[model samples]
Target chain A: MSVTGPAGFRAAGVAAGLKASGAPDVALVVNDGPSHAAAAVFTANRVQAAPVLWSRQVVSDGRVDAVVLNCGGANACTGPGGFQDTHATAEHVAGLLGVSATDVAVCSTGLIGERLPMGELLAGASAAATALDAEGGPDAATAIMTTDTVSKQSLVEGDGWSVGGMAKGAGMLAPGLATMLVVLTTDAEVGPEELDSALRGATRVTFDRVDSDGCMSTNDTVLLLASGASGARPDPVAFDDVVRAVCADLAGQLLDDAEGASKTIEVEVVHAATEDDAVEAARAVTRSNLFKCAVHGEDPNWGRVLAAVGTTGAAFAPQDLAVAINGVWVCRDGGVGEDRAEVDMSGRAVTVTVDLGAGTEHATVWTNDLTADYVHENSAYST
Target chain B: MSVTGPAGFRAAGVAAGLKASGAPDVALVVNDGPSHAAAAVFTANRVQAAPVLWSRQVVSDGRVDAVVLNCGGANACTGPGGFQDTHATAEHVAGLLGVSATDVAVCSTGLIGERLPMGELLAGASAAATALDAEGGPDAATAIMTTDTVSKQSLVEGDGWSVGGMAKGAGMLAPGLATMLVVLTTDAEVGPEELDSALRGATRVTFDRVDSDGCMSTNDTVLLLASGASGARPDPVAFDDVVRAVCADLAGQLLDDAEGASKTIEVEVVHAATEDDAVEAARAVTRSNLFKCAVHGEDPNWGRVLAAVGTTGAAFAPQDLAVAINGVWVCRDGGVGEDRAEVDMSGRAVTVTVDLGAGTEHATVWTNDLTADYVHENSAYST
Candidate 1:
């Protein structure tokens, strides 16, 4: 159960022949509710997809009745024609749902700089609208996958309501949102402003912390729709926590399915002068190709960590820095400390902890090891 | 002839037990001069090697008598004890040459976070000093190899003087400097202040633009020593040009020998608002793993280029951008232009030109393609 796990929601997925392989490439989710409060976030990349530009306007009024997403073609860098394609898509979906075109959001994924197969896409959208069911959340999740090995969905229960979400991203995972598409639904009686705040707060620490490849995408988007069907207004703070938990769960699933990744690494920076410093330091380590490769080989090369940190402006003296691989403190006071042989990295998960020895703040960033498979997967063909 | 191509300079490389393979691991270059003038540049990384700290002080007074370089150990992140070792090595070289220790510079390369075998290093320095000859530049160049497949040497002749240099670095190449160690010798009658300015100007475009892997090392150093044997005193501008030419030659050689690289990429950003913006935009493209991988696959995936450009804070509207791969205008006005098949990438050199269409300034950054071989070579070893 994903978006349809909540009340007053229905979804469906259908094949559109957009992909040469004829995979399911179109999905629709409708919010049939007493209240249509919604919020969203998009990629920070300036060169956004046509769907992103269209959806930003659709949710600007804090009201959305439906969402239409398609895979197999990222209508990015497609210029004015692509924007018109998105506008037509929204209009078609709104006509079928008996709603205003301005209340329908659109999303797309696949190769950039290409136009979508409009005829096939429109036909698939009609089929999806006709097949809409309360149990179609799983099918919607499956339709949005590009290179993902598995579909991702999560659900968090509230007192009398619940939050459900699904995410699709396998590579180009980075800050300011991964190359991802996420949709969430909640049946709690919450206002649009609170929903927007909670979504931002949750994504800031969850989705934004996953820096798998340090490549931000032009088509990333996350949307949350709330319907007051449950009539349950739990504590606002508790509602926020549930939303965060759901986002965190989806983020973990995305990491687990990251393309060509054999190990999931958690880089934790402690004793930072500020939270921003901690984040900057951790991101530095996560983005170091040499460090990522060393972790891939389980070499326990802590010096690369220090070198990566040195490149940043975070407040920390070189002499006061320390690093640990797994649970073994391999470097202390910027020099060799315990035996590096004691650290084991044969497992699928690796933890690298850095002690800035500065102040009292910390942050963690998730990433993947650099592998030959990653290089091959990315180079063998164009995505 | 490399460093010893100039008159009044003696250099030698000798084997030291520090290297497990018993290869030539210690080198010495001496400036026997009527006038001793010198300038140097070290890695910008704050967590510098012990030898870098020692060499910065040795060249502080704009005079250097000798430079001692060793491979097989970087002596970085080794704390105060490592500093003491560098000081001792410099003092030993000074004792052999009968010069003040303050005028002797030192450089080290190889694995970091490890102490050098002081006994073997000092003994090797003595042997290098005893074996030094005016024609030993090539041997000194060969001695500084860590993983480099070939020794880098260049010579540029002036009116009555000449500039010659040697460099060694095959990986960890990035902005500020590759993980490189360079020594240049000149017979020009130039002052230390002019030499400093000339060296900075030369490297700012040459070595500083070679960002092979985006990993700045802790032990990068470049030293220029003038003996003033050619008292002709050529035009200052001509001397600076010669230095720049020599640096460019050596930088090209280093790029050719970059570890596990199959293609040398030149990312040139044109029509930028400023030179700095051009550099920032080009560097952003050079550092994109997806773009690099696409180059390795010989795929003219121009979308990756636009995505990379969109990540920078440089001046350019999304719709005004254009990119050409190998002189083929594949993307114009931020969308598809000429057929991508018109671009050819089946060669060792690949040029990606981005037109910001905002102004008139331009800059170029050199980089390497990401390949499975690069991942294997880096991951299979600790260095």
Candidate 2:
């Protein structure tokens, strides 16, 4: 089972002592291809990780040949020493692969403000380089796991081209543009400009819409590396579509795997006067703890839904609003309408619809129901 | 014991059937005045309650002789009918007290979007009026309790001038000007202009610093009515000083009664580049769930404290930051310093200090730690 999305890429995953559990803590993916064109998105949080800083600087030239990722310690808030460690890690990877240090991007996620174990990390990198193979993509995906229960990997094959990607995150996932650590590989011939545009467009609606908890991470990074090995350059428009499809699929996986989550909720805000209003209302519902808890309990509490909507800055008369949960019209014209007891929630997917009765503009956001496990998991960790 | 602090105001509290548990739910305070001058502040949430709307309108003329308060059914999101109920409640109070309708202010809290129980509410209002006496302030304070373990009342008396206030709220309390509902009566002779100025100044630093939870309420209101009954007029500066002290004391009481609150955490952000930066840093700490939980468990997790500060918009070099928990400096110059085990948290008050290393600006915010009870209580009810 080759983890590489394209024909000309090799991948490796290995256990590093950085993780206390001795799980595969390091993953390496390299482009053995016709082009090194790449584009990446980093966390918008002002308090960024050392890897984020290094990767951001590496990708500024629109070229990247490989990416190195490790789990167990997010080298964030470690001050100057952390930044030095990130630079050294990239340099070591570049030296082993015979590539320029600037072409090597790095990513990490785990505990914040913890220093990387340099000896174990370097040893893991060396082993990863020797273990890289064309058929090791699956193992590489599994290596990046932190608290994730399952590996998130998706491959979309088009005519003479393919897009492959992997994602890892269980909490602190709020979509500002990207929410988790993801690496996308493709053999499709595309330029950096096209890749940037496609990634932004895809992430805007997909990864950016899934808000597991409202906390933003300091180490989130999403990088798309094009090997361009197939020499079958598809139309830019078509290539963008494939990129979006891959992102959407991976985003669904992240939401489904949200920590302590029982259901993946889709909140659709339609008939708004403007797209901003639609997005605001959708995001408000997605971030509401009470609304999320009600969903977890399988309770159709439409009154709480209306209250969340009312708190948004969007202008909508309470009387003009309507809401539906799980396809049942539970509220209409701002008051209770249908019998809420009729709605079922035996499945893992739930849908909430809001009709603003303004215009045709619409937006949808993905979220998970709040559960006791969420509180338990978060509160148990002193840090 | 007379609840009036050198003032000649009659107050009373009585049980109304508004609460499901049949507890005392109504309170009235009337200033028997030689001069009736008042100022009021209300919630900034776009979605306003009926009482909030009515009070805002009534206080526009700057004269109010009495205040009517009830807990258990917050007439919010009840649409037009709710607005009518608020008007009727005020009108009834005014009619019974032989005061002008425009001279009365009303406030309600508890479940949102519910209609007032007119029959029980009216009967309770009549009873409260008949029971009103200058020494019934403590009873009035107890009447507005809803899930609160204790009644919050504060009094300040000096040189024949006095200020007395009562407050109610345990959750959904975050500061804009006021989080919960508050009523203040003063015997000092001050015009409406001076009263408004003093109230705003006092609340800016006192009630505005308490953040029990990040949830903003739709029915929060604070009204100050001056009766000039003591026949002693203090200067504007002296009156403002007394008002500030009273507000601070009342704010302390509110924080002590916060829902599921084990300890009151005061976050101080010092040496910020600007006032906004200081405030933003303080708010970031106040809103951090992880930090709150750490404090609850009596763990001095300074790393989480820095992480919380890093999320703020304030500009600062990580290497220039310092943090202290309960007077024990745990991190200095952005690196871990003293052992976190040295900090003691056996008391009910915990303090966190952050030095932004930007300038001399500073700010303080009061918040409660996150406990299992908070999750239990909030998850058990619908907004």
Candidate 3:
């Protein structure tokens, strides 16, 4: 179940001929709602795509009837023409779905600095609208796949209510929302303000902590649509929990399928003076090319981890820092501890824990290993 | 001619048997001074190596009679024992040279988180001091090589004096003085204050701008020893120019031999509102893995350049940014410009220029391509 797993929602994915492989490259998710409440987040990058610029305004009113997404061109750095193409595409989708053009959200992802084929995108939007169904969630998920080897979907059921979402990301993935496209839907009696608060809370902890390759994209978008068909108005705390769960699930999937990654790394920073310190420390480790390469090589090179941790401005005494790889305490008090040979990196999942010996706060960031394949894939798709 | 090319200095490189390969791993450069004025810079990384801690103090008094360098181990993250080892090495050299222990600078390279074999290092230091000669500069340069494919040395003859130096860096190279060990000696009669000011000014532009893999090493050090043997003190301005040129030469050598680098990338960002913004913009492009990979593939993918440039908070209009590859304008006004095929990247040197159209300030950062061999070398050496 993708976005359509939630009641009063329909979705579809179709071949827009935007992709040279003739694969499905256009997706639509619409809400037939008693409450047209929504919230969205876009890439934090200073360089944004035309679709991001258009959808930012679409989400400003906290209402979205439909979202049109594609995986052909980023429509970035195309000057005024790219913006016009995005506006035209939104209007076309809005007309087909009988909704206000201003209420349509758009997201496009692929190569940067290239304008989309407007004619094909409009045609694909029309076909995607025609194929919309309550069970078309999977198809919609499939259409958004770029370098992704698999489609991502997550759903959570509450008492007479449910939440669902679908995400696509494979490269240019980093925190501040990994170069991802996501659409979350919920069927509960929630107001625009409630949905917005829950979305911001959920994504802050989930999407904001997944750094796949340390590259931020120009077209990352995460939109949440609420269709109050379930009549069950969950408490704010409970609603946030469900949204966060779905987001975490989708984020995990994104990390699992991160382009050219051989291992999924979970960096946990503990005993930090503050949560921010923990996050800062963890992000530095995730960004270290040396550490990532060691992870790919299945070597418990905790020295690299310590070196990376030292680079952060987090409050920690070098002599008091400790690191553990897989489950083995490899470095204690910033010096060698357990035998590195004892650590087992035989699995695809790896966990690194750094204890600051400063205080109690902690945080975790998920990332991927750097490998030769990462270079190969990036070299092939750099354009 | 390396450090010893200057008058009143002697140098030597000898096998301390500290390296597993039994190669010459210990080097000593002593200033038999008429004037013992000296200056030095260490890695900006918070997690400094043991030798860096020792040498930083050694130069704090503005007088250094000798420098002891080794390439067998970094002696970092070894806790108190590592610091003690560095101290012992300095003391050994000081006793042999009949100078105070506080006047002997120390430098170490190789793997971190390991302790030096104190006995072997002391023995090597003894042998190195015994082998010190006026023409031993090349041998001292050879001793500092780790994974470096070749030794790097530069010499500049001024009005009545000369400046000579050597450097070694292959990986973990980045600004904040790049991961390298350097030693420079001059016959010019300059005070410690002048030497310090000139050294800082020179390194800030050269060594501090070469970011090979964005990894700041814990063992980076640059030392300048001055002797008044030539009785020639050129104008301070002229002295700084020669020092900067020597540093720029050594920095370029570090980038050229960056571990497994197939291309040396020069990223110049111009028309920024401030010099800091220019440096930030240029460094951001240098750190872009996608852009580096594109350079490796010999693809003039200026879209990656724009994407990388957009990530920086430097003052620039998205529509006014222009990028040129190899002097070919592949992107102008942020729109596709000039055929990408017109940009020839067949050579190893690549130049990517970005015009921000914000002001007149500019900065240049040198980096290397992200190649499979880079991954291989880093992975193999990570532990």
Candidate 1: docking tier: medium
Task: Give one digit per residue, the lDDT tens place, for model 3 in A1-383.
Answer: 88999999999999989999999999999999988899988888887889999999998998999999999888888889999999999899999989999999999888877789888999999999999999999999999999999999999987789999999998777877867999999998888888888988988889999988888888889999999989889988989999999999999999999989989999999999999999999999998888898898898988788878878899998889899999899999889899888999989999999999999999999999998998998887854
For model 1, residues B1-383, the per-residue Cα lDDT tens digits are: 69999998999999988788888999999999977999999898988999999999989999999999999899999999999999999899999999999999999998889899999999999999999999999999999988899999988899989999999999899888968999999999888999999999999999999999999999999999999998868798999999999999999999888889999999999999999999999998888888888999999988889888888899999999999999999999889889988888999999999999999999999999998888888887673
Model 2 reproduces what portion of true contacts?
0.22
What is the DockQ of the complex in model 1?
Answer: 0.75
| Candidate 3, position A232, lDDT | 88
List candidate 3 segments past 4 Å from native: none
Residue pairs in clash, model 1: none
Off by over 4 Å in 1: none
Q: Candidate 3 chain B: minimum summed lDDT over ten consecutive residues — where? A: B170-179
Each model's total of backbone clashes: 0, 1, 0
Task: Tell me the tens digit of each residue's lDDT in model 1 across A162-273.
Answer: 9999899988888989789999999999989999999999999999999998888999999999998899987999999999999999998988888888899999999999
DockQ of each: 0.75, 0.34, 0.69
Give the lDDT of residue A351 in candidate 1.
96
Pairs clashing within candidate 2: A3-A137
Clashing pairs in model 3?
none
What is the TM-score of model 1 when looking only at chain B? 0.99
Local accuracy of candidate 3 as per-residue lDDT tens digits, B150-174: 9999999889988999999988887
Each candidate's lDDT (Cα)? 0.92, 0.83, 0.90
